[model samples]
Target: MTAVTAPEPAEQAKEGEGSLRSSAMRGGIYLVVRQGLNVFLKLIGVMLITRVLGPTEYGAYVAAFNVYLYSTLIGQAGVGVYLLRHPGEVPDLAVRTCYALLALLGIGLMLGLEASRGLLTGWTGVPGYGPVMAVMALALPFKLITIPPTIALERALNYKRVATIEIGGDTAYYFVAVPLALTGTGAMSLAVSLVLRELLFFVLAHYYVGHGPRFGFDGRTAKSVIRYAGTFSFANWVWQARMLVNPLIVGPVAGQHAVGIVGMTVGILEMLSIIKTIAWRLSVSVLGRVQSDFEKIRRAVTEGMELQIIAVGSLLLGFAWFGGIAVPLVFGARWAPVMQLYPYVALAYLAIAAFNIHSAVMSVIDRNTDLGLCYVVHILLLGLGTWLGVRHFGMIGYGFGEMLALLAYGLVHWALARRIGSPDYRLAGLWFVAAALGLFWRQLGWWTIPLPFLALATPASVRRIRRILEQIRKPRRAEARA
Candidate 1:
């Protein structure tokens, strides 16, 4: 074996960053796997608990958990947005201070939850959820407090550590509490699990952050961090509030069981999000690396868009193909409601991917103002759309409404796609499913015949795949001298 010298200090630092990037990529995969595994197990747990506790009880738990999720989003303070927007100039002290503000916000949220549990009980009519909601509400702090540290890890791109902690914690939660849940923890099992999960992250986040539990905050630094993070916090609150309105609307209008159905459908949607995140993980991070070089950024963005299209198209096509068995096996028969919504949700994800490159370019160029404005509008429209859809269309209608909102957003994304950089129009096949569904949705519900129909739905990727096969099969077809 040849003698190998260690890298010099500067070279080692470069190597460290290179390794970190690779780690981030692997961590994205691991995180996706972990989420997939947890969702898979939770599906088992949901099936067991649904069968055990019955619909009303499971609905109560899912409802309370939606509340918990919305609350957790409030405390992010958009630290990730802020950090991602300005990675080069974000000081550690500022990050610490932002963490401080979020901590305070989290504590206040917990207190507010405790103070309002009686109101929630009255509003929800799930008196059993009173104490459980109180406990689950406190989980907001545990979850939110971890964000700063987690964001730091994300910025550093040393995501394996964070991903490991998350996976380990989730695995612990599944193995430990799922049994109690099956034995008959009811709605409380979910609340208890939420607390346990958040607390685990709290401990792990602190360990990763190298920050001891301390309350000493700097007023000056806090003011600065607040000034920067305040805008993010507002955007976050708006987005979270937008998300919360769905459960608030559907639960009251359609009842807890209906909300459970909707949540179950969305749970399937969550799997798509995991796919989207993993596919875009490197694309998003690479935005940071290509900030100033417009020419280089444009080229990188082009390659990234191609990758996003191919990847998301393939995934969505696969999902649309296999979702019939996958949906029922994973989420249980009670959530059979999801069977109706899964394909449309896949279409929505496809629409999102259609503009993934534009999204990256917009962020790389620091177009948050425009992006935020558009999202704010989208959120407002979605809120109205969800309400009308829930009231008029019921479950399937809600899916229709979501698709419409996605359609509206997709157009905006398409228009902006040009502004960022023009992309191939062929990707629009992913977005026009709504147009197709409007034409054919009434004719076909869950077209599981596996005959000629489902193949017709995912035409965008099919065309691309056909082209690729042709290219592969006929590499010399283009090279023949005329």
Candidate 2:
């Protein structure tokens, strides 16, 4: 009998790395498809709900929803991130500990919101604000419980299952919310739909994982998780504070109608920047595995920046060119203010796309302190800029604040570049300048119409496009050979 030979460690490592890359690539594709579907689902739902609710009622919903979103940062506590980025297999004890912590935090946040419900209602001065918040708060525990199972799937790079759960939940939300809104349920339509979405997600997450995490606690595991989670949560909390600015500052300064207008502008921007969201989610899992390799991480950041700009820049510019007609036609004249706000907000999201990978890298490398400081600078600038601009310029002042906050990305870039040598931003920068100019075509006139095309015609841009085409084709060629 012939002797069988085992693979050497070097060969084994190479094979393992290849497997990981394949999984990550497939996972990324799944996420892109998922986000694409979500964007369609959410856009339709927003249009239907906004048309029914109008500015005043929708503004009230936005205010309460913003509070709920911000509060979730605390409830999450970043334990899921700790699980996702852990170097190797996480112990069952640690996973159970994370579950216990998340559940407790969720309950704590719920009770805290309930206790302060009256104050929040009085402060917002919007009808049905208190009840809406109460309903949204009830979803907190279910939302938190889904985290461990979701992280389990993410850790395994099984984004197809994750995508399925997310898409299903989102579909269920609009299915329920739109009918209720058409029936004149007002803001509460969204509140009820949100609860339903979380419940569905919670059940589906556990079911897909085969079993839910058994509740348990270990002192050492809890402490280690908290140590990492605390720093991570602090950075995230400060970052998420941006969500509160509209409700706390814009709502007070410009009133509910203006709040609705700004909220709608942001909501639309969020839909268009779905690529950024997918990239961030993919980075957290993919980069975490290669945290020890500075070169790999640096290359990933450079490629990610170029690809994101190419993907998102076109969408922003297209919206800028055509949104004026579409918004008024579809959502009614009440949403016309969204056009004026779109350019400024679009610019911010574009800048973020250019450097978002840096934030993900920082998290992978356990540089949460630096991340927290960057967030602090950003939130402070954003808060100050919005406050001064809103007070002075009225509704448009919020746009100015968004413009001013662009400087914060500079801080993030510097922090990350300091850690891992700077990424190649040439293509991203070119696309960014062209997209920025194109966004103000109303002000710049026909001259700006051809700029994005001009940017794409550059040799660097052409080379990048060819490389992307090759990458896409290579997969099909390999599949054919197989």
RMSD of each: 7.0, 4.3
Winning model by lDDT: 2
Off by over 4 Å in 2: 1-16, 479-482
- lDDT of the candidates, in the order given: 0.61, 0.85
- Candidate 2, number of clashes: 0
Which pairs, if any, clash in model 2? none
For candidate 2, write residues 221-294 as lDDT tens digits: 88998898778888888888999999888887888888889899989888898888888888887777668899
Q: List the residue pairs that clash in candidate 1.
A: none
TM-score of predicted structure 2: 0.95
Each candidate structure's TM-score, on Cα atoms with residue i matched to residue i, is 0.79, 0.95
Best by TM-score: 2
